[model samples]
Target chain A: MQETRLDTARIRAARQAIDPVFLDTPLYRCEALEPGLGCAVSVKLETANPVRSFKGRGTELVASLLAGDGRNAVVCASAGNLGQALAWSGRARGLDVTVVASRSAPAAKLERIRAFGARLELVDGDFDLARERAAALARQEGIRLVEDSLDIETCEGAATIGLELADAAPTFDAVLIALGGGAMATGVGHVLKELAPGVEVICVQPLGAPAMTFSWRRRRVVTTDSTDTIADGVAGRRPIPAVLDDLLVVADDAVLVREESIIAGMRLLLEHAGLVAEPSAALGIAAILEDRDRFAGRHVVTIVCGGNVDLDAYHRWIGAAPAHRS
Target chain B: MQETRLDTARIRAARQAIDPVFLDTPLYRCEALEPGLGCAVSVKLETANPVRSFKGRGTELVASLLAGDGRNAVVCASAGNLGQALAWSGRARGLDVTVVASRSAPAAKLERIRAFGARLELVDGDFDLARERAAALARQEGIRLVEDSLDIETCEGAATIGLELADAAPTFDAVLIALGGGAMATGVGHVLKELAPGVEVICVQPLGAPAMTFSWRRRRVVTTDSTDTIADGVAGRRPIPAVLDDLLVVADDAVLVREESIIAGMRLLLEHAGLVAEPSAALGIAAILEDRDRFAGRHVVTIVCGGNVDLDAYHRWIGAAPAHRS
Candidate 1:
């Protein structure tokens, strides 16, 4: 995968696209968290949104752009929260949205997405197949696809989160994000590097699905033999070449956090921070906790990406004895 | 308990005396929540603090007042989250804080309070005895009492949350608070009424310990014979006379909510709102969901008081099946 260099102009456009409604959330310096991480840790609590995820920023911006063409129908394929976000954003603007998902998607999320007035297209296959089907449907209907990855506009929209982060807490030494399709990390990193030139952009992946990290190191698009992690949101089998290139070009560091760390991160965010972050959202913090020495005394920001986990799954995950990170 | 009859001046004084470190939280309208509540439901999300509970607001305010008198020693009696907040606030201000708690208090919370640099005074008896011992120690040492109930400074501190709600949100028809010692209700209600006269204040109590509700109905303080519920926060045997007086004067309604509703509320807040609120914080929402017809179309706000629940307790409660309210 060749690096796709991103410029400040694209980031600037993203900022304009996501102003007013998309807020610059608080860059809180967590004193308690700082000591443990051995760094002056500041969290960009992306979970503090009306939709409870940083995905809302991207979805809202994308929806606004799509609304301009007088085409009301939007389509997307998601594991859970992204679909809910698209439906919600579309509903807010009086637009119709269709979300395609596999049967493996969490029931609560499917119910919620439908409740947000989105028509559900259930695919017999998994997420990749669902994405392909949704793309085809969007093309057939000439509807706007709020695609999770491979869309420049969507990545630009996601980048606005980084723009907001830079504006809110400019003195960040490093920033962390969970890498799925690499849309969030690429977008956020592009904006942050342009705004704060020397700030380190860190991307975290679930150990079970460390495709982005491996791809970045190998300098080639490589898929894992099998992807298995509790953090389904950041679990992706195929690495988008363009998005991975963009992520590597801007990211200063990348790490893979274990499943146990993800659970611990979820508990910490919920118990100490009063945030109900999904497993994907907790990935960045989980990485930090796993290797605290690497981030000590540096003003760091991490995104709590989404909050769309099944309660039953969450109960089992947090309740069971944590699996040791081998 | 006779109504204290606080005028605008008293409420204003309360607001002024409280420290500004604890932010005036947002009062966002929950469009999703409006369906069941029958009214425009707004939630004052006090769990958005660094400490993730409304207790930070009151604790900071009380700590500031104690520090102003040059008293280094501060003492409070709490089950969990409150103790942590007090310890953190006390530590921040360079004051020594002593937290007295029973053995029933969660181990995690005790550890957290200690982590925050507070001395723990574990009692052999229950919460009531622990509180009594704390009060006695405070009196003996002449240390400032950062009491949750009955302290003028504490009530004043808690009142700032109300001021923020009135200033942030649209004028509401009613306000709901999960009542324990009546500090939160008294403080918040006092400000809401002063700012918006049309607003009616409502206090919600767990059926297991209906001290505030009982007192509101009987016009006198009543001690419960026995109390055991999922909501450990609002399990106080008796209401503080001083704050109860304020509740009587300002409150327009008091309702008892079932424990199941509290659990449901916690789950909803976590699932829908992406907030990890304790059962006490969920009480107001529980009341609204239990009798949605009462809240129809009227602008209503519920204070999410605290988020210091034990993980095991939270898992057990939220995992259970919903029960029909009596």
Candidate 2:
């Protein structure tokens, strides 16, 4: 891996520029979910804010950066969460934001992106192709292109989570984060490794979409043909190369969890924790369920990253999971 | 109304001494639920804190006061949220806390109360009898009794919600609160009346527990022989006279919604707003569903006041409510 360029100072500076709404999110003990997970768990809930996701922290920081760059327009490709975050933050910073997404992105997120005052450009292909199209638009329009994990600002913004979790009283033995495009995993992993060297950063991904997990194990870029998972938020077909390099230097371990466990994880959070979490957000909890002994008797922390899900999908997945614990 | 003794000054003062966790909770616009509710809706989520309820704000404030009053012990009657809140705050204040609760209180809450290091005394009958038992225990032990809504500090703590809502944008034409012994309603209603006099405060209660609504309208104490509702958090059998007098002066309207709507409201929050609200927390949203015309075309605000739900009951209610929205 390349010599580490990610610094804790950059994350501290990012925290200084973030919107107050996205800062100081609820980090509390998940008392009800502790017994089932076989560990004392404290969850950093990133869903209760404006966009119902953690994307706001990074996107808002990036938007603030664009405010002074003599730029009024920015383009990005997203499944949904990043688009909503960019749109919300862009509106606050008076930037004209454009989001490119495939036709099959969740309507809930698509609607939110538009509601947040961003121009939506629906593509006829996958998120990767959508990214190519977004780049083409950025080139054609001469606007800034912001991609998650590729942008230093995005990574630094997510690092604030590590800062917060470190300050919390629970001295977590390990932190399990969902491996999406690697922005959150890489950012948080780097900060935690810097602040608390003893803490292990475990990156978790869906078995159906194991690009990042496989890449982290191999210490190189690994791209998958097609992703198949209900956790669309974290189902990345390709891991950003830079993000993978950071993950190799910072991440302690990686695990792939089954699709069934992911659905059960969402149900577990709602039933046991009394909070709603989307499939991607429950990746860490799914990892624990998949291998409880690995986390047994250890204090663990997980980020409930996003809570945006289509109602039909949410209900169907809840029905597919095992019946109530209580 | 006894010349309106409840003052905003007391609420503001209480804010100074609150635990930082309980202050400045998430208050944001619910974009997805706007169409369903027929108005712009903002939700102040009081459930995201340590106690998973708004009771912590009041209990913490009261605990701080108890620290200086030559008191080392306190007793209170609770269904679950209040007991857990008191126990958590008492532990922080280094006080001996005894909680008296009925046998029927939620195990989720009871377990948390015990976990927070409070002595739990379970009674045979309903919550009213539990309150009587708690009062007797307090008298026998010569300890201070902290009753929700009856104590000035408790009401003042809740009033901070109104202060926060007033500070936020998306100004509301009316604010709806679940009437649980009139603590939250009386507190928030008083503050909103003082700060933003144009904003109307509408107190909502379940049809099964209409004591507060009836008493507020009649300007007297109203007692019910039985309270039958799934929203055990706000199921008050008898209205406190002092709370009723305060509500009579502060609240502009009171509405009682059916059980079906309450369950459906919970479903609505999970589906549209992506939140898991307790039956009582969903009270305001249910009221909006019942009388859509009353809130149509007007910006409305509601409090998701608590989220401590029994998993068995939560699953059953989710099954009972109407199926998926998408």
Candidate 3:
């Protein structure tokens, strides 16, 4: 499939547009992990964000852009953090947001969205089914569809994370971003390529959800039959075409990290960086840990994408990991 | 009791000085609880900080100040978040840190402090004994003593949190800070009073460890026979005189939040803010929930003081909350 490159200038403009709307999360150098990895590892602490996720960056930007012409209602489908971000951002602007999620979506997350004053729509189906229905309903009602992956604005918004990172740690040799709808990787990678062209941008995906990994290898978007992972935030079935193009243009490589690695990564993030990351958010760290040699002796920054795991899930996942993992 | 008015401008100046060093932790407004309370209750999420606590603010400021003249070693007597913060900050600036803790300090915390590159000294007695040893050792080794509360720099450093809160939510009618050595409550409250004179500053202490609370009420520092609480971070016997004066000038009231309330507060911070705060950090939230009417129709901000609770302690606390209580 043919692809179009996102202009670097446009990415910078997106940064300015989104800067005031979301938190400029800190970047901290991880000395404990650095020596072991043989790399100057820095963690982009997105968990410090209002919604406890980098999704706030994209969701707030998209919400602001969509609400520009007085639109006050938005709809989306998310299993966790995305819904919370949309709800909180919508509440901030006095806009109404409806989140459609499967019955299996953690009750804690559902409660969080409600806490932010967003209307909840319990779709009696899986996340993909809910997404499809949400898209259809949004089109019918003329309500802005804030689809996480399909929307160009969402990708542009997620890309601002890259801009902030590059500005904060301009000396990094490589940037690692967790793969979801490919929006974050595409957006961040695009900007980093322009700012520091020699720097490598690596996209990390859980082995269970290797849609992006498979798609990049096949050079086309592909669907997975079954992609089950604890990293629910990034467990998308297929990649978005626009984001795929951006990924192809900027991402140097894609790394598939195991579920155990993701869990270990979360534990390490908490222990060393004083940050909490959901399984999906820790994929970048997992990827690096899985193959430390690739990042050895290099200045690297890993994005801790989000923190929205339910207590039951968190206890089970974090507990399953052996102590002294860090 | 006579108390001197605080140097409000200096407190503001200290805040500005640490602005670049400390992460601007979010003030997340709880819109869901607002309807029930008839007030906007927000959390100053110190748990999102680089060291996973507001202790980072004080530690960063102290470390920056101490390292100014090429000094490299600093020592502290804390087994909780303060030790971890000082250790992390020490490593970041190429300084060495030693944390002295009682033999009773949790093994988990000792492990974390070591992981952050701090030398650990486990004294034979309780925390007070460990503190005494740390002070003597600091003098003998020519190491700077990063006193948690007694040091003027420590109070000034903690005051930045109040400045950040005022900047983030200037209209807040009341500010709730967890009472420790009275440093956090004193420093933060001092600034809040100066920034917004009408703002009521209330200090919350754990019922079991209420030395600061007792000191304020008695108009002099008082020692408890035995203090035990889940909030180990705020479990101190003595209140620094300077801190007591600051508290007298700015603190409108002091409340003792029950242990059960602290547990509930931790769960709420985790579930709502996606933050992992220790019991001490959640004291302010506990105070609000326990006495919801006190803040009705008012805009209130609570400083989540710190985040260094053992994972097991967190699990046990959150799991053990009685069904009737919640």
Candidate 4:
């Protein structure tokens, strides 16, 4: 397997370069959840920041680098989170950010992207069409085209979460990451394998969109005709080549969970942990629920990657029945 | 007005005596909430800690002091949050805690009190009866009796929150604090009056339990026959004399909100701020909605004091109708 470019030394010092708001997120052990999971479960809540997601760490580092390098403009394709993150990070560093997204993206995320002072371009089609538009726009404007999982700076920025988790807890059996563009999974895995070598790094993906899962298992890039999942954060129709290489190097195991399980996980997080976790953020909890026996009696840590779920959709998807009827 | 025992000097240095987890909570500015409040709104999320409440700050500080003073045994009457908080804090300090609660107290809080390893005594009446039983038990067992709003140490500890908020933002028009047993309200008020004197210190209470509200306005203790509200955290039929004195001296204004407004505030917090605030914690938002003109075009800060609502009752009280019906 080819070596990944993520560095542990840089992750050790990443906190200094990254924004303070994204560092030292709450790592809470909810005893209420132990009975359900049959294991000691802790959540590193990454949803309480300015961007309400873990994307800020990497985005901040990259935006700071751009500021130092005198690159004043950039473009990126986002489902929602990365766009908001880059916009916030860019504004903080006085850099111009242009975010391209599908017109079908959730208004909750799009509103935040615009609120953060980024120029938003909405394509008529899907995420791939938005990506192509972003690439074309970057070339036309003579600016950089930023992609989440493919950037070395982004990966190294994400590694800081692993750096923090290792420093916070002395030991845990495993750490679960929600598998999406593979930036968080591969970046966190790289840090844990080096700092907390005893930990087993696990990646969880929705069964509906499991390109990374298939690629990691088959040892090559995997592509699907289309993605169909409610968890837009973890939905990938085609796996990036470089992210595939890093996923193989970082993850010890990969699990695919059904759509219902993802909804159940989101509910569990709300009921037990007293937090609102978006569908993609709850993928770890779903994986554990799918195979309770495997995680039983073991201590585990999971990251709540975001909390940008549209309230109306959240209530519908989480099986929120009318209390009067119940 | 009688002088409050809360000291600003101690509050500025209180972090040294408190647990690191309860300090420096997330202060996020949500743009979506801005339009609703007709002003910039920032939330100091005090619910993401181990106990899921701001109670940890005072409880931890008092626990440390008790440990230092060689008081190994203590008893307190709690409606749930205080019991759970004392249990967790006592365990950390190697002190024994006995909690007294009314038999009708919510099972969610009772379960957590027991989980924290506190010896719980159940009374057959209301919170007033529970307090009486706790006092009787303390006399019989020869242990110290601790009451939240009556204790100077608790108030001083709560003041730390105000110190941090003042340090966080250079200025804001006002701050809204949910008036419960008045520990947080008085403690935070004392610090802000000392440091951020220009900022308005507004206390919010439920219309069903307006003892503190009336007492603050009258500059004397007030008592009510009964309390009826969904916000148990702020339900007080009889105001503590010491706390009433502190309230009169600290609070610039007091607002009473109806039951429906409190529920609406809880919903606003969930939808706009992306948080699960119990009825009491959402009082700040309730006050804003009650008189939008008062806070219009101003930057205000509010504390989400806790997130310990029972999921089933939460759904019922929040008017969570089925999506299909909508």
Candidate 5:
């Protein structure tokens, strides 16, 4: 395998470039979760940020760089978290942002993007179609398009998380990351591979949206006819080649978790960890639960990538009693 | 009124003494919540710690000090968060901890305390009765009872929060804190008053449990006949005189919020901030919603003190559709 050159110095710079709100998130040993997983598990709370996701780090770095280069506006297509990140960081950097999201995107996510002062353009098709619209818009003068997984800067921004984890707990046997478009896995994996050479980087995806896992196994991009998963954050049918290339070098293995396991992960996190993690973010925990034999007695770190679920959806997932009219 | 002398130097030392997991929590601008309150609102997420509450800081510090002084076992009475904090920190420092609680204490909280390896004594009475039992137990030879709000060392431990807020945003017009036993309000307020004298420290309590607010108003410890509120964290009928003394010197104003408003605050936090805040933790937000006139156009910081609600209780509070079995 050809090793890609990911600048450690640039990753360090991204740590400095990104807003402080997204940096140094809570990474603590989850005592409540450890017993069930049969291992020492530490959770990095990326959802505690203003955007309720890890996307803010990469998007803020990209937005800052763009704004510094005299850009006035930017556009992106997102399933959810990235759009909100771009909108928030863009608003901070005084740049106008337009997000092209699929009509199927969660209402909570769409509301957050608009709340951050971004223009929303909902496409009638899936996320890929929204990406096409964003790409077409980018060709027009004065507008730059940011593609999350495909963008090197986005991955570089995410590498800062690895830097923090290495500084905090460098001796972890494995780090489990939820794979969506693969930016989080690649970025954090690259940094950990460099800093903590002994640590294994594992990527987890929902069985319904295992494009990245399938592609990684075959050493190429794999396109599925359709994707269906409650974890909308990782519900993708296509894999980007750039993200795949990085994953090949950086990731040790990729695993698929059942949709039922993902739902269980969400409930465990909410009840024990006291975190309202979105379904996508809970995939890492699901992976751990599915393969307890591999993780038993080993120290592991799981990234809670986001928490952007609507209250109603969250209630349904957690099996809580219906809302009362007090 | 004679102002009490709070040690600034000790507070700075406490910032150094506490565990890193409970320090420097995310303090960011809450964009989704701002327009509703008609002000720039920032939230300090104290719930991201291992105990999912701010009580860890104080309990850990007190436990460390006790362990250093050759103490092996400690007793404490708590509604929930504080006991969990003591149990967790005591276990970490190799100290045996016994928590006395009311029989009516939430099952989730009791489970957490047991999970942290603490002995639980359920008294068949209210919190006051539990406290009396704990105090009586503490009088036995070689056993020290750690009271939550009345201990100066606990308050000093909590002062570190103010140090962090001052470092993050020192120019805030005011900071609102939810008052239970008055330790959090006094500790954070004392530091803010010293470092950022211009920032007003406002304390909020539930109307059903207005002991602290009434006592602060009367400049003495005031005991109500009974307490009734869904915010179990702050449901106290008796105010400790020492805590009241600290509040008189540290707090600027104390306010009461309705139970309905507290429920509304929990929903808003869950929907907007993506935090599953307990009713007591939501009191600051409820106060803002109840009195928009005082907070309009001003930059305010609200400390989300804890998140330890059961799933069913949370669903009931947030008015989500009833839980669906898979």
Candidate 6:
């Protein structure tokens, strides 16, 4: 296996370079959740930041580097969270940001992107098509294309979350992370493996969009015909090559949770943790709920990554009757 | 005016004695909120703690002191959040806690109080009557009365929030705090006045429950016949003597906001900041929105102090059409 690009030294520096608003979020033990799961669970709250998501850490670091390199403009394609992060971070650094979002992107997230003063381009396609369009736009003069999972700086920046967890709760038996474009899992996994070598790093993906999980299992990039999940943040159809490469080296295990479980996890977070987590960010909790016996009597940590759910959708998802699962 | 009992020295010690879960919550700028309000606003998010409210800080400190003084049991009367805080803190210290609550207490909060291992006693009267019953119960053998705002230790513990805000954002022109039994306002106001002397400390109360506000304006304790508002946390019928004393010394001004404005603030927090703040916690934002002309071009800080709203109620409140407010 090829050596991982993320290291402790780079992660330490990224911790300093990233914006302060995105760093050192609260990592506390969830009293309401521990008894039911029969384990000690610590939640790292990433939703408390300016953008209400963990995407700002990686996007801010990447945007700062682009600014330092004298780049005038940057382009990216996102489901929602990444676009908002890039737009906010780019505006902070006085760099122009153009986000290519799928036409089906949630209105709440789209509003945030425009609110951050970033130019938004809606593409009549999926996330992959938006990425293709962003790539083509990057070829224009003085434009840098920054992909979420493929960018090494973005991954290293996200490693700061691992550094924080290690400092806050070093005795965890394992850490559960939501897998989207794979930067979160790869970055956090790389640092935890180095600092807490005995701690297992598990990646969780929604069953509706298991592209990254399938690719990790097969040891190759995989593309799905369709991605159907309420977790729009993690519903990518194609896996990025660099993200898959990093996952192969860093992730110890991967689990898939049903869509219904994800919705249940979202409600649990709101009811117990007083958190308003988007569907994608709740996958880690969903994974633990789905396989409770494996985590029983163990010290575990899960990242509550984002809280950008639409109010209407949140009400519908939480209030709806539980779907019958065979 | 009499010297405030809540000094910076006590606040500093309380910071060390209090539970770490309630300390150093996120203090960040709200980009989406700033443009509309025409002022730079920073939010101190107290809802991120385990209890999902600022009550944990005061309750934890008081509980520890009770344990140190060889107390075996304690009794308190609360509308909701305080009971949960005491129950959780009491359990941590191995002290039995009995909470006297009114029948009108939110069911969601009652469930949490029980979940934290507290004995609940329902009274058929209002919050003040519940307090009277709790005071009588404290006369029992081996039971101490733990009053929310009257306890100097509880106020001192809550003062740690002022310490954190002073350290985090000291340049604010004014700080808007939600007034509930006057403990939060008195505690935070006391410290901010000492540290940031020029920064105005404004206390916000619902127009329906103007006990503290009326008392502050009258320069003495005031009682109201009935308290009616959606912000159950702050809807107190009478002001505690000790709390009113502290507020007289520390609070610069007090304002009353309409119930409709409070609802608007709650919705704004959810839509703009992605925070699920309870109605009481949204008072600071409500004050700003109701009188936007006063805060224009100024740096202000608002404490989003709690996130204990029920999901069903949250949906109903946010989904409802805007009331015709002139």
TM-score of chain A of 4: 0.96
Q: Give the lDDT of residue A16 in candidate 3.
A: 56
TM-score of chain B of each: 0.90, 0.96, 0.90, 0.95, 0.97, 0.96
iRMS values in order, in angstroms? Answer: 12.3, 8.1, 11.2, 5.5, 2.0, 12.6
Off by over 4 Å in 6: A34-40, A320-326, B35-38, B320-326
Question: What TM value does the first chain of each candidate achieve?
Answer: 0.89, 0.96, 0.91, 0.96, 0.97, 0.95
* Steric overlap count per candidate: 9, 0, 2, 0, 6, 0
**Candidate 3 residue B108 C-alpha distance from true site, Å:** 3.7
Best by lDDT: 5
Each candidate's DockQ: 0.19, 0.35, 0.19, 0.45, 0.68, 0.37
TM-score between candidate 4 and the true structure: 0.94
- For residues A1-326, what per-residue lDDT tens digits would candidate 2 score against the true structure? 33455788888888878887788888777767887888888788899888999998899889988997768999999989999999999998899999999888899999999988999999987788888999999999999999888898888888889888878634678998988888888888888887777888999999998988888888888899998888888877888888888888888999999998997788788776777888999999999999999999998888999999886677677763223422
What would the per-residue lDDT of candidate 4 be over residues A1-326, giving only the tens digit for each residue? 23577888877777788888888888877778778888988888898888899999989888988999999998999989999999999998889999999888888999999998999999997777788899999999999999888988778888889988888657578988999889999999998887787889999999999989999999998878878888987776778898888889889999999989898889888888888999999999999999999999999998999999887788887766534422
What DockQ does candidate 3 have relative to the true complex? 0.19
The best candidate in terms of DockQ: 5
Question: Per-residue lDDT tens digits of candidate 6, residues B1-326?
Answer: 34887778878988777888799889888877887678988899998877888999999899999999998899999988999999999999999999999888888788889989999999997889999999999986548998888988778877888998888555689999999798889999988888878888999999999999999999988899998899988888879887898899999999999988887788788777888899999999999989999999989899998888776666567763322212
Better of 1 and 6 by lDDT: 6
- lDDT of every model, 2 decimals: 0.75, 0.86, 0.75, 0.86, 0.88, 0.86
For candidate 4, list the clashing residue pairs, or say none: none
Quote the lDDT for B64 in model 6.
92
